[model samples]
Target: METIQAIYDFLQTRTWLQVNDPEEQIVFLAAGEYNENYLITVEEIYGTARHVFRINHGSQLGLANQIEYEFAVLRALARSGVTPRPYYCEPDPGFDELGNGVLLMEYLPGRPLDYAKDWREAASIFAAVHAQPVDDRLIPQPDPVRDIARECEGLIGRYPDHPMTEARDRLLRYRERVLETADEFQTLTADDKPVMANTEVNSHNFLIDDETGRGWLVDWEKCVVTSRFQDLGHFLVPTTTLWKTDFEFGREGRRDFVAAYLELCRAKAGSGMDLETALRCTEIMERTILLRAISWCYMAHYEYTQDGRALRNEDTFARIEQYLDRMAWFFESKT
Candidate 1:
């Protein structure tokens, strides 16, 4: 209640608009993987217009900067009409007691894309997002493969010992493969150009407007400037399989999605992206995405076990095993 009141009080301080029943208007929405989301509806005193506030509480350490960067990204994409409008953002000092950071943005009214029916739209939306020009200062331009390799190295160092020997062995093997693949991928796309890539391309991150049928990509915290294929692989591979079973695409669906993306690229006259090279990059990045997933499991396991949250150990190990199984399946299918 105090936190809610604090948010309400903070909202009242803003000079842009007047709050309409701040106490009663604030409603808790779904909590995301990294942040708690709240909806605040306010009415303008000068008119009959009502604006919804998407208040996001970013509690993680490094996420405060991510929230700020997301604001910048949204601002850059404002003219593109594919992202929610960012209104305000505050770092840790502003909401020290409640969260590490807070971001208030326009509440987009839409539902998550239904992958089976919306894959083509999803591809088009991503292509449009990637095509937008962004200030290089706000978005990081890191080598995707080297970045994943660093993450693997960090996870190994952070968790020197694993509770489950089998899990540890799997992680070690996965890291080795990732490093080798990264080397090859670097050689394969040495001259590849970077684009505005959403490092996290899950289905839930995309919201399709019910009225316009246009897709809006939300949750820009993981947005970066990288190879377009990195985003493409993440979207078409793990993301499709993770959330909805109905959205899982077989060979035909995958082909159609790729076709749509390529067609859009051609229509937009995308520079530095060729069909042959992009296809090759996609194939390599799919394996990189698998390794990235495994790295996430390792990080989660380390955090869960080290934070005195042993109760979640079983679930964490289960997730690691599942990712390993997926990785093995991927390799087997490729062979």
Candidate 2:
């Protein structure tokens, strides 16, 4: 109650009034990795309106340059053809003295996208974002290949624990295969189709409206400038049976999805990439995901609880090893 009072006091200091009406009071929305978000209708001395604010109170990343990040997001969205409109950003000055920073912006209303139905639209959104000429200041200058390699190394470093003991060597074996494949990946030719690399184009990141069937691509945290195929691989690989979901696409179905995307890209750009090359790209992405999953399996065992229950440490590693083998098979099958 004291903390809530303090927040109210802070808002009062800002000359904002908390409307007591059900539609006007702040309502807790979704909780993210670091921040607790709120959807509130605030009234000022002169005007009233609804706004969304994310309070990063318990974030390990803290709110360092968060307002700047939101500004970056706003810039990125305005530049990109397929993104949301960011209305405002609350700066974080004394957040460290209090807690994590708070970022307030306009709330967008829409339904979340269905990955299976909207895969092409999602890919097209990334394609358009990547196609946009990026401001070097907003772009994080990092070597994509090197960045991915470092991520792989971090995953490999987590091995040899109790859960991964039996599977450590196996995972390493797959890593070696991917290393060999990486050299070949360089030889594969792709049109210099621009793709926004920074965005994580996973299923949950997109929102769609049921009425108009328009999809909104959100979450620009990992937006990057990279090859179009990389984005395609990331978008396509997961739609396959790689992850367990109520929605599943069979081998042929997945292949067709990739094919359709290629056609869409070619139709727009005049030269789409070949299937074999796309498969190779998928291999590279699948390898990266495999390594991350391997790390996650170990972390889940040693650190976190799953579904409010302690996960079996050994079982997690076993699943990772099994998935590693599955990926290796996927690679060899492609070959």
lDDT of each: 0.66, 0.54
| Candidate 1 segments whose C-alpha is farther than 4 A from its true place | 45-64, 187-191, 244-246, 270-276, 305-327, 330-335
* Candidate 2 Cα deviation (angstroms), residue 170: 3.7
| TM-score of every model versus the real structure | 0.84, 0.71
Cα distance off (Å), candidate 2, residue 18:
8.0
For model 1, the local distance difference test gives 0.66
Pairs of colliding residues, candidate 1: none
* Model 2: colliding residue pairs: 130-195, 130-196, 197-224, 198-222, 198-223, 198-224, 199-222, 199-223
Cα RMSD to the true fold for all candidates: 3.6, 5.6
lDDT of 2 by residue, 75-184 (tens): 76676646756664555424442244555555655665566677667656655665566556544423333455555556556433546454556656656655665555
How high a TM-score does candidate 1 get?
Answer: 0.84
Report the error of model 2 at residue 19, Å. 6.4
Candidate 1, residues 26-100, lDDT tens digits: the string is 766655545656777665556544333434444222444666777777887777677888777765536543455
For candidate 2, give the lDDT of residue 12. Answer: 55
- Candidate with the greatest TM-score versus the true structure: 1
